[model samples]
Target: MDAGAPSEGWPLDDRGVAYGDGLFETVLVRDGAPRLWEYHLARLARGCRVLGIPMPAEHELERPLAQAGEGVMVLKLIVTRGSGGRGYAPPAAPAPRLRWQLSPLVPDAARWKVGVRVRHCRLRLGLQPALAGLKHLNRLENVLARGEWSEADIAEGLLCDGEERLVEATCMNLFWQRGGRLETPRLDRCGVAGTLRAVLLERLPIAEVDAAPGVLAVAEAVWLGNSVQGLWPVARLDGAGGEALQRWTIGAVHRRLQAVAHEPLGYPTRLDD
Candidate 1:
């Protein structure tokens, strides 16, 4: 797998493109090694089991992952149900297609250190418990939510469900500290269960809860995170019309979590740097 050409041949009628029948994993590769490899695979396997898509062998992925080479890069792997019968019907015997690409990781040190301003998106995610936490290919809801704002200063947007219960950000998982308690949105109804979120759940005393968007007003600190970008503290949150909803200064709790993330995940320790 050359850096210039990361993907294999893609068929025209592949189900991944036609019906969005596939799962993807974005892995962070540092110094020719993939970070959180097993967690990513576990999530992928879970998605495969849920969607009835056959899981590819570990060796099949290891080969291309090894070619990611040195320096920091992002490895995007896609496994689709392959070409199937016309329309929504899947093939009796499926041959899953594994496509992958490697690209240079973008730097987000400024956002990580100084914190970012986020907005609340008007777009609400629909409930689908069966497909709640899988990284599936149907991401139009996220696509539209992310497009709600184009301001350079607004780093991300927070999304809610139809009932106005906070779910997650457009691309990252949501977390916050309130009264010295760490809490994150419950993804059992919808939203992607990010690999980094899983790691934090295992390592920290975080609690998963269902709360309304108004809960942020009382939060001590807010955060948005993903596997690739680490964690970003929220300096401010704005409404749909750009009205200030809440604000905060990046404090000790964020730094403490960054320290915990740094050791196992390789996030920068000195965020102010």
Candidate 2:
């Protein structure tokens, strides 16, 4: 649990908790240290700028991270417009709330070995270019789709936009192997551009397209990515899947991603000098 106060406590009323007028970033921390800390902070700062809220320093969240205990972990940082009155008008002297949480992260064992099963969700995403790529708090759509499954076997669920085009998985970005190259949905109009997705595009040769819904069903293999999971393969698909959807279809990119996630410290410094 976070130790930060309710500088914008209830009765005070924060617009974020009240109206989902905020942004968040889930960072992947290993051991007692954070990975790509600056990158995650950069994105969070940008999100605050987008929503017109001032950014909080990383140390502001250090207390919660310390309380998080140990091992691989997830750190969530939420910043919202603090204490509003009645209307949507900004507070005369707004106090932005910085709520943070850190907790142990133990991914399903199967994910590391065999990947996980997934299905196409019925809930379609709404197109909102303004908020398409940012990690905002108004995620009723993701929550609804994620709630569609109760069983633990269902590792993730794919989502289509209002036009029935593949956008992404519930909380991760999607990537498909077409026997030659990698293809993924463009998040310009919908979906969150994941941190791992940014790394892949910046590091590998990939494609950004408005993938048709059937691509997941027809692709040779599929995978999903986020900062935490890196890139985990999709072992099985329950739909009009491709040619029986070859089992354990681990592509080159999949292996590369796994290596990056598990051994980020040993990774070669490929960033241009």
lDDT of 1 by residue, 99-212 (tens): 888899876888888899999999999999999999999999999998998999999999999989999999999999889999999999999999999999999999999999
Q: Judged by TM-score, which candidate is best?
A: 1
lDDT agreement with native, every candidate: 0.88, 0.73
Off by over 4 Å in 1: 1-5
What is candidate 2's local distance difference test score? 0.73
Model 2 root mean square deviation, Cα atoms: 4.8
The deviation in Å at residue 223 for candidate 1 is: 0.7
Q: Against the hidden reference, what TM-scores do the models get?
A: 0.96, 0.85
Name model 2 segments beyond 4 Å from true: 1-12, 240-248, 251-253, 265-273
